[model samples]
Structure formats: C-alpha cells, structure tokens
Target: MSFDKFKPKYKIHSETENYFKLRAEAGAKPYDQLTVEEAREGNIANAKRFAGTTEFEGTVKEFTVPSKQCSDGIPITVYRSKQCDLCVAPSVFVYFHGGGNVVGCRQTVDTICRIFSRDAPCVVVNVEYRLAPEHKWPANHEDAICVVRWVKMNKGLLGAVNRSTVGVGGDGEGSRMAALVCHEVPDLGYQVTCIFHASAA
Candidate 1:
C-alpha cells in the first residue's frame, strides 16, 4: 500500500505492545525525561532482556588504545570472522553506538558488531568514544575522525587492504557522526550503510 503522509497506518505488534506495557508497569520514564544514569541503564537492561541466553558465533580480540596510541585513547574491541586473520583481512569497519551519544557504549552494540564481523568476514572496530554532558560537542566528532584516521594509520596492523579500505559508520546519532567524519576527513575508505527509522505515533 502506498503510504499517506497525513494518514499513515501501522500496527504495534503484540510483543512490542507488551514490552512497552511492561515498561510502563515498571515505571520506566519517558525517553526525554530520563536521567543520564537511567538512560545508560536502560540501554544495557534492554539489550540483556531481549537477548537472554542467546549467543552468536564469532571471535573477538579486545584491547585499549591509550590516548597516545589512537584517537583520544579509546577502548576498542575488535571482532573477527571465524575465517579472518591478518592473512585473510582486507577491510575494517569502525562502528559507533546510538543512544544520542549519551547512553550507548561498546557493549550495547556488541551482538551486531560480532555478526557484522562474521558475515562481512572483516575486522569490526567497536569504538567507545567520549559521550556528551561530559565530553561536549565536537568531542564525539573529533573522536570519530581520530578513530577512522587511526585505522587508516594502522592499516598494516589491522590487516586492512590499505588506507582506502578503512570504513566508518554508526546507528542513529552515530550514523550522523559517520557522515560528519566523512565530510571532515575527505578520504575515509568505504562508509558502511546506515539506516534509520522513526514512528510518529
């Protein structure tokens, strides 16, 4: 059916309906009003609540890059495909999490990163950039730029094909950050596709 901007139609699935119902019963605050701590907690809690007991296949090598080593010295977790190694590596995707850049961290998007690494059969760099209400504006953007540059700068170690194979992306706010980085950096490899959606109801 063709969509009508003024008269859009959709249904809230029962499962989704129940989730919100449960949240209401538990006194979950509206998103706009949530305290920073509450917002952070909700991101983690929702991830666990939805993913209970489910495990996806992948391999991970994690490490912290001191500020001296990479952008802002962020904590980065590298997820790899089962078949991936320095010999098999050709590209790296740097990802950022949503949460308005206020709530999410590396862990919040762990599952997707693992899946991306495995399915793409490439290295996934999950970056934990400084958040707002703390780091301030341009800080996140700077971190994004620096991290992508770091990947390009360390392509030999990351097993990337070359500086041109270093890509960057994120969900929600992160996607916009990716675009900003692409705009500012001029030459960040391929940018991963980022899709977003919202409901007016």
Candidate 2:
C-alpha cells in the first residue's frame, strides 16, 4: 500500500526536524518522562545548541522585584539597547521565557531578550518567575502579576516614566502568562508575544 497519499498539511521546520532526529539518535526520553532536573538541563542545552548568536549593542543589568506572593522576590534582567535615546526614555517590556512553568531560567532567553531590546528598541525586563514541582500553582502567576505591578509603579527603575511606557510579554508558556496578566492588569501599553496564539477576545 502506497502511503504517499497521506500527506501532512503543515510542513515541519528544518531546524525542528533536525532537533527530533538528533534527539532520537541520542535516545533522548520524552519530556514528560524525564526528571525535572533532566528537563531543565535539556532546555539549557538545546537553547545553547540551537539559538543563534546576536550582535547586541546594549547595557545590561540585573535587579529583583519584590514579589507579592513571597519574600524571595523575582529576579529580572534589564536590557537597554544602544539605539535607545538617552534623553527620551523608551517603553519597558516585562519578558518571560517558556518552560511550562516547570523549567527554564533567566539565562535561557537572555540573548533573545537582547534582540528585542536591540530590534524592538524597548527596554526588555527579562523575568525569572518561580518554577513548578517546587513553588506550585498561583506562585508563578502571582509572580508575573507582582512584577508587572512593580514595573508599573516603579517606572523610574527602567526610566520608562512617560505615557504608554510599560508592557508585558513572552514566548510559549511565558506568553500565556503575559496574556493572563493583560486580562488582570489595566492599561498595559502593549503586549509582545512570540509564536503564541492568544485569544482575540
């Protein structure tokens, strides 16, 4: 029986295909089967192996936002591109990285945040929210809300004091948190999501 008749409607990206092939060759276990530590390590390894380097021209700094959920606080990295005007402050974005709220960290999306700051030309506030199998539900969500609220209130931290000066966003699961935040927080200037299908309503 010829199976050519059964064709896939969506084409797989070459890089994605290569990833699966490589994983299979290495006998990698499915994500669900792996221990939390293994999954987190794999995420870091994949990011380093596949994510291309960017020529970022910017100033980078780190700070912590006082979380409403806990005393530990949320850590954040601030990226300000060289192109940003010294006199006129740019809008700031509270960024989150995707890892199903289970894995991934600030470094996982560090370079991507640089690209956003350089290309999108905004101050990128990369967030480090709590992970699961540890902090549990409402912890990560509350952390995101706390950070955005903190940014909204402490606009001077990023020098984004002007109108429409604060926004929130992320990729994948992180993007999901951003969308949820938009629903809860009022007057969020903008939302930048990468490869996330948020509801139009």
Candidate 3:
C-alpha cells in the first residue's frame, strides 16, 4: 500500500508533515533488520543531514572525559549560546541521545543540543557513551555518572560557577539514563537543579 494512505489525519505543521513524508519515501530498514554497524551509520548520516539543513547559532567545542576501561576517554560536544559570555555564569545542561543503548553517537543529537543551548541559554554537553550488546549493561549508566562528575569537577572550564544550576536531560532511552543518573548518583541534589526528559509529562 502507498505510504500516503497511512499519513495521520491530525493537524501537523507543514515542516513536520514534510519530514514524515520524506521518511516514508526513504524506506529505511527497521532497526531490528539492520546490523549494529549499519544502524550506527544510518543514524550518523541522518544526524549530519539534519545538522546541515538546520541553522544553529551557538559555539560548539569538542572534549573528552576519561572512561573506566578506555584510555581514549568518552567524546563530548559542548554547545554554548552566542551570548553565553554575557551572562554571569551560564547553567550546564548535560544531554544524552535517545537510541536503545545500541545505535547512537554524540553526533546523533547535535541538533537537539544546539536547540537546547540556544533556547535555554545554557551550556549543552552531549555525551557519547558506549553502546551495547558490545558493552553490556551498566556501561552506559556508568559513563553518564562519570560525565556528570567530570562536569561538576570542571565547571570553571565549562563557563559555569561552582554552585550554578545543572540539569540532565534526554529522550527515549537516553531519558532512562538521565533518570538513572539522578537516582543513583550520591548527593546529586546539591548539584543538579533539574532533570528533563522529553517523554516525561
């Protein structure tokens, strides 16, 4: 059957409608059908395409956080608003991308980080945690905790004050990770001012 017949009747913005149409046209294979490497490549490609088409008015910097086993450390991208320097001390927003612990990287959510940095007027840090089943359980969660600690320890370099507001956010699987971080981290209440998940009501 034609994909158009499956389009929702509910009202949606033209841009969103176009996106859905394009997605349908692309005929991308389901995640379950693709190998992990193939899925990662597709996810990265989609992110790059979206980044290219969208306009983000923020300064982006790349950094790495030391991981438990890997000496290379975890990759992270920091997005700061253009006016961040004008503020007394900008807040920090750590973001985790929403793949099912298997298919996303830091670049997968570049646009989301840019949007948060610009709209919230905060420093947005995108974490690139190791995925599974290559890494196994608790690896992603462990990385999340480590990144949070790293940010807390280096707030000065991140353009945030010691007691400045810090928040954690994510979508889908990433949301689960954010919630876990908030729950499992000791004395997190003293540092994290908020926890935001797109799927949370």
Best by TM-score: 2
Residues 1-201, model 1: lDDT tens digits: 112342346654667666656666666665577777877887777766654442445557766655642343777888766545534445788998877767778887888887777767678899888898887887788778777777777766654555336788888888888888888776666776566421110
Q: What TM-score do all the candidates reach, one by one?
A: 0.78, 0.87, 0.80
lDDT: worst 10-residue window of model 3: 192-201
What would the per-residue lDDT of candidate 3 be over residues 120-186, giving only the tens digit for each residue?
A: 6788889999899888888889899999888878887776788766778787678888888887665
User: Global lDDT of each model?
Assistant: 0.71, 0.79, 0.74
Give candidate 3 regions above 4 Å deviation: 1-18, 51-58, 186-201
Off by over 4 Å in 2: 1-7, 196-201
Candidate 1 lDDT (Cα, 0 to 1) = 0.71
Deviation (Å) of 56 in candidate 3: 4.3
- Candidate 2 lDDT, 35-131, residue by residue in tens: 8898888778767766668998878988898865788779989998886765376888899998888878888898888988888788889999999
The predicted structure with the larger TM-score, 1 or 2, is 2
Candidate 2 or 3, higher TM-score? 2
